[model samples]
Target: MLSISSTRQRQPFTVLILICLLLLLPTSLPFLLPPPTTRPSLPTLRSPPRRSPPLPPSSSSSSSSTSLSSSPLDPLLSLSTLASVILIHELGHYLAARTLNIKVSEFSIGFGPKLFSFTRSIINNKMNGEEENIEYSLRVLPIGGYVKFPENYNSSLVMEEELKGREKFKEKLNVEKNEKGILGMFEWLNEEEEGVVKKKVKSGSKPKITTPPKEIEYYTDPNLLQNRRPRDRFIVLSAGVVFNFLLAFILYFGSVLFGPGLLKTEINRGVLVTSEPIPYSPSSGILHKGDVISSFNGVNLLKLPSDVNVIEKEISEIIKTIKSTETGNEIEIGRGSERITIKPSLAVGRSYPTIGVSLSPNFSGVSKIKTRNVFEAVKLSVQEVCKVTKSTTKGLASFFESILPKFGGGGGGGGGSISGPIGVIKLGSDVIGQKDWSALINFAAAISINLGVVNALPLPSLDGGQLGFVVLEKVRREKIEQRTMDDVNAIALFGILILSVGTVFSDTMRLFGK
Candidate 1:
């Protein structure tokens, strides 16, 4: 029922161009944007380092068992997983609509031409008596999906059809009543007594009840979504995001309870210096590739609370010490069995002060551990989802905050970076190459949460945007003009398409840069 206009149909080419621009723009950002005129002279603390690339196994046997060579199919697997996530999102909308007895026109995965399609008649218990046909379809493009509701639900043509259907239902009821004879007559009389049917009699004469009611009213139509209550509309609009979150939680719980289990990184000793510092850097002569830093300026790094992951806490403390360094700074290191202390003179007033060395937790190894029971799995999964949701919300808020200023010619948007579909596929491929299947599951869960968070944003063309309109209608107590709403949605959709292209392009450039 939702038709694409000729102008809208030609947007794919424009989208392609945008994608190309996005892909190429990041690589050219240095030349396109002017350098900052000022810089911070003081050292600042930052979050812990991102996970390092997976290390090669030490032995050939370990390599064969723990790692896999990169394959051509890696991208395909990643794409499939993404499609599955999108499909589940659409399904959520479909289920929610059906639950509310709202008629849905089509449920589709992907865009463009239909690869496959079928229609099924679903019987709604509240339909006041019949089935509505819904089309399920798969389209050629694997980019995204949608659940379509009839665009002209309130049109005269639709009202006419509904009238005919109601007439037929009334006839069916009359036939059943006639078949029941005397009992049906009593049922009709009871209906008249209860005000279900209007009755009239001459002053003193007894009223005569017909076998069938003279009129059948109060037959509510629950088929049109727009005609539903605001609460129902909100539920339908928000169901996709809810489903995405639920899927992520399920994946996390399964990974912890039934799959390869959740991964736990055991920290051993202190922070391992990943690479030696540059020749002229502050840590040049003071640190080496294998040095394990045990303490910073007399603060013991290994002493941590029982309930915390020491790696993040230790790294935070180390960074704090380095940022707060004054005239003298000392680091205690463990080299084999020898305890060595070194004082490195860090350069001041050079943006962020650093020891100029790559560092990570001195991890003994990674191990898979499962929850003791289903209850534990549920608890852990909920915690993981909550943690991820919190971090994602902060990250999204920070990204927008950073980029918004840049839009007005202000600086510092460089920190608000993002990746699109291509980036996700590439990340999945890397996980597959590492053959850390458990990590892959966790990655999928994180992606699922990310999808939910993005959709939940109050941005145009997203689910949240539609929800906003619904809320506005409720507050105003009047429906927004259908044409106006359509135009807004069309414009928003075009903008999003352009953005997606750019994101894809940017991600491609990043992939190649790596």
Candidate 2:
């Protein structure tokens, strides 16, 4: 019976391992396959466009090109990037606690059983003859990390005991009146106390309490997280969110400054028409090559004349609206310097209208917008981060609103609406396969921003939840009972478990095309 129970417990981990193996193995196939003998020729019919001769490859360029061509199934790079970002977030909390003189008992990356661990002694004068050892560990699972602190009541009791012992020693030495003075003013000590102090001073012994019974310092002796001021605790709680946001902003800045050329338009031109009209198509006579499309169905193509922001989004919306319609639509084009309006009729038996003209694949007449200086990049990055944050917040709210109703209805049609770990891995694999640094970097930045925003939410089991408890304690001017805190934490854990299970189920359904 026990064996059966243990096997059941291990099944989820076994399945997870299998899933990871399946997801990663296919990506490595390209590495095993032979390299191409020569560059593949482009498809004919249009007569492939002319290209510039290849430049000589330097060492750095060669390595980068190789990386670009590497198999998309290689999960190492993406996984490592994610792990590093999470580690930095946790480090923010650790650093803040250490800065505030609060003792952190353990610092660990990941969850579950410890895979490896090491201890480091922290020697400080405030430790009161106690040795402070911090244990750093890496755990089996890489989902998240934590910094553990001594229990508040235990730490307070130990500190009170230590203070009592110090007071007793002062009484024994008859130097209670000298408490206000520096240690060097030992003149108030009686002969016996003076002799004892001299012998100890000569021996370079640590400060001792001679009156009370001797006691060994325990784990609770050091000043702990709860002993810090409220503001300091708040900082410690919020530092992870701050670090995640900082990482996201840095990634955004890098993607803009160093990524592929940003899509833009020429000063007075729109998207230049490139392809000749298709035969018997809606645009056969009305549309022609070299016509720049400036608007579609009464909507202007450019939201901002000079800025490239929203260009892709507007274009996508326009295409979606056009494809959804079953009738003709108006298109405004720039021919030379003249603006002309044309009505494109729907092709026979097709649902959407067709102009039959193709946009320039190379963006021939359009401009590539690149940051000219670091200041502009920084400013743009900030704006991008703010925009992402707002959009993510709204999305999360909508997701919750949609899912909460399904919980009671027993419905199962949200498979495509949300993503879990499996979905994320699949998406990451796709991005990696594309071998585009800009896309990968932008994806990473989005994930980082999501992490920051999600963690900032006032939900139980999250950093913001901890901050909420701190705020409650401050308001009540009393510590919450340990039992109550435990109950809250347990409830939070259970809620997370339910959410995770549902999300994983949804992801699986999507994976199987349900």
Instruction: Write down the RMSD of candidate 1 (Cα, Å).
Output: 17.8
Worst 10 residues of 2 by lDDT: 29-38
lDDT per residue, candidate 2, 1-514, as tens digits? 0000111121111122223434532111000000010001111222223333332233543356323554744466656555566667777788887887777777877666889999999786666656778899888866446667655454345546868987876674565436544344455667777777767867888546355433433334336665566687789888888988898788767755775423222333244455678897666776666555665555555433533223433444555554555455555554434566656667667545656665532232222234758899898888777866765665566467656768778432222134555555555565566555554565566667766776677865567776888899899998665435545755764575556565556556767877
Question: Candidate 1, overall lDDT?
Answer: 0.60
List candidate 2 segments past 4 Å from native.
Answer: 1-67, 126-130, 141-144, 153-222, 258-369, 406-417
Q: Candidate 1, residue 269: CA error in Å?
A: 8.1
By TM-score, the best candidate is 1
The per-model lDDT (C-alpha) reads 0.60, 0.55
What lDDT score goes with residue 218 in model 1?
A: 21
Off by over 4 Å in 1: 1-70, 123-125, 142-144, 153-222, 266-365, 413-417, 490-506
